[model samples]
Target chain A: MAREPGGEKIVNPNPMMSNGNNCQRLFRLLLGLLLAVLAAGLGYVLSSLPSPAPGLSKPVAEHLEASGVSNPVTAVLLNYRAYDTLLELGVLLLAPLGVWSLGVAARHREPLVDPVLDMLARLLVPMLILVAGYLLWAGAHAPGGAFQAGSVLAAAGVLLLLSGWWPGPAFSGLPLRVSLTAGPGVFLVAGVALMFAGGRMLEYPPPFAGALILLIEAAATWSIGITLAALFAGGRPVAGPHR
Target chain B: MSLLQPVFDIVLGLALLWLAWRAVASPDLFRGIVLFIAFGLVMALVWVRLDAPDIALAEAAIGGGLTGALLLATLARLESGGGAGTGRGKDRESEPNDE
Candidate 1:
């Protein structure tokens, strides 16, 4: 709150400077207090909860047979509620574009972290990728599916971003473009193909419902992974400065 | 209060709020950007607890991930040729020149 000048220090020492500092400190303090209150409320909800849902889908159960995808949540996400997933992809598309527009771009060197953290990221990456694939495949019977699987993959992308591997903004290229469009593109084409062949849009024509759902989900899974990784890169036009 | 849900919820919530508060309070604009990314992830978890998987996925993938990237990129632009923070200061300095 004190300032020194060549000769002006004795006069006022810029009372405005002290006032600005006080305002900033007060702002931070109030912000912390607000956060504390929010945290307390959140703590109450998280630590106190009801039992988990039975992992069943009421809509799927009521109208149709299992379709052999025993995990009703998977069925709901991939089949019954497939449209929601499509729109989700749309939001994914908008985020990066917004970066290029609303955000300024940068061309920075990447950040450096503790070697131990780097090692952990390295170790976690491949394992998470494998787990994601397995989860995607097993969604037919387990409490996992495209969404969960995609998240795990996204987690890996995040790890890559944090670890200075994939970098950011400069992520634009063939692969990124491909991954971004692949999910909904495949579904739209497949649905059209089925429609042209006399089936309904996204209608698998009987027993293949599960298979079609799987394919759509697989595409979605890959798209989600890429989108997340790139999105984690945010709007920076390039990599980041080493911190 | 049931079982593990509450525990996860509290962790998720506090983690998010901390990030938000820090992002607001951080003196170095760059630090605030990073903290905001963390805040996004924690909020994604909150969406999950609310049983909105769709929202959670979007939050995690787009909200948390891309927004951080954008902020970092902006900081990069602010830094550009010289060095990041210095470049930003230079840009600030050049403001009067443009006028």
Candidate 2:
């Protein structure tokens, strides 16, 4: 360590430790080994898992079949696991609020722009939105559902963010509050009404079980998709005419 | 679960880990952030393969999307005063946080 013209010894921050070069290399090697072990453990656990059968979650299986949703996952997500769907919507809605809150130190709002990206967004957003609707409609018989469909819409929001097309927010305190609650709210109403009539939750009298599940799922899917999209868009209040 | 799911899990999980490594190893903060977002999406795929679709949902939303936004926003915040943490002055970014 050489003294300056002012006669002070330069206290080196890291002398032998140039830049944590070996520290980083060691970290990478450790991380790789850790991941490898994780993968092996996961494979073993998954292999040991019981395969799908009639007895494995029989209630889900039977209720799913009774719902007339040709796809069992769709039935599980909408009918048996409808509460999860509802809570997921609440989570989705809460997410943007969290993001926005983290940005309390952020400047209010900046003008978003990118011409080429905007043009591409124009081409894609409509089609993507249409597909989200279709997934909700066809979930009963297909491999898709409100969650997958909503994710697609969220991707569109990313495009809009890149292109500067989104106006941001779509009535958070009211519209979001309503839509987020609507799915479970409808399911609860249906359950109570069904119990009063048939003495069971989600158990319709006869042929109605199929119809009822479908109905509840459809509403749930719509609410989920819309709420998710709005959340993705940052919950900025632009659903209605903002001009 | 589909037979292909295991293959997807193994491949995607490795890919995710790779991206995360690159994100930390990158010489540019912007590139690091982008790579991290990609890493998050791949992790979400891993969750899907693990038969935990609910975790996938939360991860995709928060891990990939919202966290990406936050990272970019923080980078933007450092536009005025830069430091090693911000990869300011220089165009390069350093390694990952203390995981």
Candidate 3:
């Protein structure tokens, strides 16, 4: 029997409950042992693998010109494996959708006014936005891309939210929804349009591939940014009386 | 310099494993979350060491920063909704209104 903080004697009605702690400990030990064995096996397998394993880098480099981006990662994502990227965007869009479905609106609280935080948000948000733009633009030839840029943008949004800046009602409604859907929407539209034009879905004409990739990336960055930020908000933004 | 790289890598790998273990086994929820974030940041460093800067950037931004924020916010909400010192082991059925 355990005593509660309020001096109430808590009785364990179930006899089996007495051994629960020991059972749990034994279970954990077994699980940990199993995991250790698995890890060792995996490590052994990895160590036995061929060094510098032959990959598709050669073929990717060969087709890089036609893929419309100098960066092989970007080429693969936006061209060779565009369908995967499209689906990925769809998955990203689903996050906020699932969160919003929980029907919990973010509780409106009084803004905590801290001068330093306010100044930091003001200074950092714009800089972060600029960095996101640069990242989107540089994706064609660098490590940065829509996902990274969008995450940075989300960081900025989170900073603002933390510093007590809420989106205006006007911006949070239709505009928010549109931005959230823009990535997958654009990708889907492009794929369907390309199919209509007699090419395979998401097949970019070699001449127009660069332009199309940039457009898709820009939309994806926006959508991902908004989606992640909305996800952090944790629920639907209920306005006016409902809020 | 070459020897230093290997030493650094070994240290980082051990730190990552230790942090991950501590994060999982920590008794306090807040401490566990903070350790998890530290684990994430360390994981990001490992990604960079593995020459995957893209993954590193994404991991740092999303995994470390945003996840930490989300977890802390959730903890705060849980504490507020359930009242202090009673955030855990409470009956879910009793709390009808989240606010």
Candidate 4:
């Protein structure tokens, strides 16, 4: 063991240990340089690309009216490439599923009963829910959409959890499961039903496209909110009598 | 106005890079996580600067807020579980020796 002049013990007293630290530092520096070079190369390549790059914006705009949403982003996500969105919902569902499959019970901590946090949670959660609803609805015409809205809703859920509010046993069992699955389930069912209704999977009739997209977004928002919060919970709820 | 926007963008880009490096290199795990969250937020601003508000919102909410919370919670759990060679315990163990 080596001691500093001020009588401080050096954890890595061995000369070889110091060499190893130098090697680690050198490796990190080299890696950073490599990444920087790669990034610069990528930027150079991007800069050389033709301005006003050819894209699908024209075609998307041409068919936007039929896609049922005034917002082009919404149209792209829900109508133009709905299958991708459906799979994304599945991927979101997989997260909580994987976490829950670990079968660990959520750690129950003693709830800190702070008046300010309690009041904030009470005030903010409802407002978040409202904002989520507005986002979902306005997504048809603006920048708002299911993902943004669901994330807001999820934020609210996270806040509630942070404030030490846990779902009741009754709500956590079947209802919770349903909410978690609702987005993907609705999407899958809609696709299958459309397939059976004399159309290809997810090929919405222009007349009903708006309604269908809205329905899916609504379900997706709820499911995403609940699913994300369940992820924050870090485990499955213990099986109550209802289960 | 145009010059100001570009200058702001440049500063933001530099800040993002600095924050990212600090977050990765910071010795303290908690400080690293907080820095990472800050990095996420700055990245969100970058997204907005690129005119991608949707991505910006998602980044702010999921990337910064939820993920930060999750990381903090995981760190707390790791500290409480007395995981060897991880988190605050290592710092605490080395603190007295340093003095």
Candidate order, DockQ descending: 3, 4, 1, 2
Cα lDDT of model 2 by residue, B18-67, tens digit: 89777766656787799899988888888887776655755776578766
Winning model by lDDT: 4
Query: What is the descending TM-score order?
Result: 3, 4, 2, 1
Query: Residue B95: error of model 2 in Å?
Result: 17
**Candidate 3: where are CA atoms >4 Å away?**
A1-18, B82-99
Model 3 DockQ vs. reference:
0.30
Query: Over 4 Å off in model 4, which ranges?
Result: A1-15, A241-243, B82-99
Docking class of 2: incorrect
Each candidate's interface RMSD, rounded to one decimal?
Answer: 10.0, 12.9, 9.4, 9.0
* Alpha carbon lDDT at B57, candidate 3: 86
Candidate 4 Cα lDDT to native = 0.85
Q: Which ranges in model 1 have alpha carbons more than 4 Å from their true place?
A: A1-58, A64-68, A100-107, A167-172, A235-243, B1-99
Better of 1 and 3 by lDDT: 3
Which window of 10 residues has the lowest lDDT sum in candidate 2 chain B? B80-89
First chain of candidate 1, TM-score: 0.67
- Choose the strongest candidate by TM-score: 3
Clashing pairs in 3: none
